[model samples]
Target: MNKKYVLFAILPFALSACQSFPTHLKKNEAMIVETQSPDLLQTLSDYTWIYQSSEKLPPIVLDLDAQKRIFIKTGCNNLMGAWQFDGKQINTAPLAATQMLCPPEFMAQEHTAFQFFNQAQLNASINISNPVHPLLTLENKAGQKITFKGEIKPEAKYKSTGEVVFLEVSPNKKPCPTDNTQQCLQVKQVKYDKQGIQTQIDQSWQVLPVEIQGYQHNTKQSKIIRVKRFNTKPQTATPEYAYIYDMTIEEEVAPQK
Candidate 1:
């Protein structure tokens, strides 16, 4: 192991039986990138790490969410597991994964990912000097090293979990709010109750001059989607509140009668 990498993990008794990693490891934004010594667990949860092994595979996304569950996206099947970091190495429970059949290349890469994250007592190193683009390296006992680069998550960037709101987007576009020549998505607020039943929907459509992250509108079909809205910080000088696409509720094409 490299002497420069200082990993301060808990003892055996400290890491009691639990499906997830220790909650103490999961801290707020303050413990992340703003100190002389950054917390490893906090940084892992706040940033999305991209696998840097092969350029052929659609970048594998390895991230540890606030809940301490390990999530790996191989662009084929998703690999999930709960991990624990002892003072020496990392050990994860038997991984849970989706059984999706993909191309040979993707499957081949997925195999390597599954082996690494599932392996016992793996050595890991992280460097968060550049908050925007941190680097993580994991080495197996066989002397093979896998690297990943980090990108700050939206929730981390905005400093909040943000409000989850639903919207029904129209199939057609309205005139853009600022530019008359451009077109924009016409949307209305959709409300759902605790039972997941429709409660209310805004009757009138409004011009959405801004774009929602991870969303792509189809002119032929109207769709309802769930999204998170966050107040943009003054430093970014972005919109009043930034919208990120969460999931699609429903969609359909109207009969042109």
Candidate 2:
């Protein structure tokens, strides 16, 4: 062999025989570190999480209850399911969703979200270094990650179970019976059976003086809305029934009187 080739061949063997070479090579081999587990059930319960980033659709809302129930609002459709959290892993059951035609973008976003939660196993982590602004991250075996930021809900803040009710709001805001100067929404309670069939609808409309927490009224359209009613103890000046809009069922213009 040529002198140069012999030197090169021996150099690699010599370096491999040195102890420092093993250490140097070990440094380059990547090591996979496992993530620490946190109290997932406690951290995830009761709060509502909104997706921080989305393509062209509205932010998705996620809610986890203490009863292991999961609720999701995917811009257009409402989904319900159950979730289980072991010490280190999380799993979700089959989710049922409302069948409503939505914009193509919204539907695509919903499909992506549904697939994320419907995964067989997911690893969850919560970063609470900043208590005021906590971050939740979920990772799957496929290396896909989804992050969410949460806000405490009104009922969750108070640690109370809210009464859920549905209301149909008239398209036009009529004058309040007590105060003609104040315009109010004409609303009526709608009742449903265990099977979710509409059992009763109050024909008489009542004037809703106060606005619903999450509802945005459209001046041109009526809405069938679901609301959560919370009663504050040691009643303050606030209304007896504090309403938070859950979802809108129908959007149509009410007949003008």
Candidate 3:
């Protein structure tokens, strides 16, 4: 047997073994793929990242929308910015923040977040060990880290962008139509056109069967509110649609009768 021929034959086997076993990859880093799926943004945008500093403190909310816009809530004022993920890192542009004075504890977290995210490009990692609950982490050059838990966005889970509906809520509650034992919201559907001008409204108020998320009507005031209407999952929900409060369009204290 020729020595050179034996060495050349063994080289191919060694290369194949190396290719089969990529020892360079760390177990924790396996999911941070170099070639991410084409719909990476869609996957990321589906979830909202939340940072809960403590059970007593309010959680910081970070949302990534389809327009490449980042919406952040820091317990006081909202922050808006742009963001991009380049395989190994997440880059956040300098944010445009609303200037509002908040409590010291709230502002302290806000300051920390500003230092972490404002105009910083960070190394990023995601742990999808459990699909039901995902984790996203960002690290700076100084080895400082911020970890956020992920929750599926309402729009993504519902599979619809949701319809915007206007509702006028009466200050008084009435007996529910379905359950006379329970009280219900007195509401009238208000209609609008593409220009957002009022087109029509229900003549009589109706007892609402479902509760509106994020709405707590004051007993002394009537309110006209904007809400996103989404269809509930069939067979699993009592109401066919769920309304989430978007904003209060109008409010007036009801005169004592």
**lDDT by residue (tens digit), candidate 3, 1-257:** 00111011111112221122123334344334424644565667888899998887789988877655677788876666766666666666667676889999888888887778776667878788976668888798789988889988779888889988888899999998888899989999987665556677789988888999879879898878888998886566464888888777777788799
**Candidate 1 residue-wise lDDT, 1-257, digit = tens:** 01111222212222223354333333343233224333676777788889756677688998777665677888888787766554334556567677879999999888988887763456778887877899988788787887789988888998988988888888889889899799988889987766566777888999987888889888877788888998886466564878899777777784464
TM-scores for every predicted model: 0.73, 0.64, 0.73
Instruction: Supply the global lDDT for candidate 2.
Output: 0.67
Per-residue error for 75 in candidate 2, Å, reads 3.5
Stronger candidate by TM-score (1 vs 2): 1
Query: What lDDT does candidate 1 reach at residue 3?
Result: 18
> How many residue pairs clash in all the candidates, one count each?
0, 0, 0
In terms of lDDT, model 3 sits at 0.73
Model 2 regions more than 4 Å off: 1-40, 76-80, 94-102, 129-133, 174-207, 234-239, 249-251
Model 1 scores a TM of 0.73
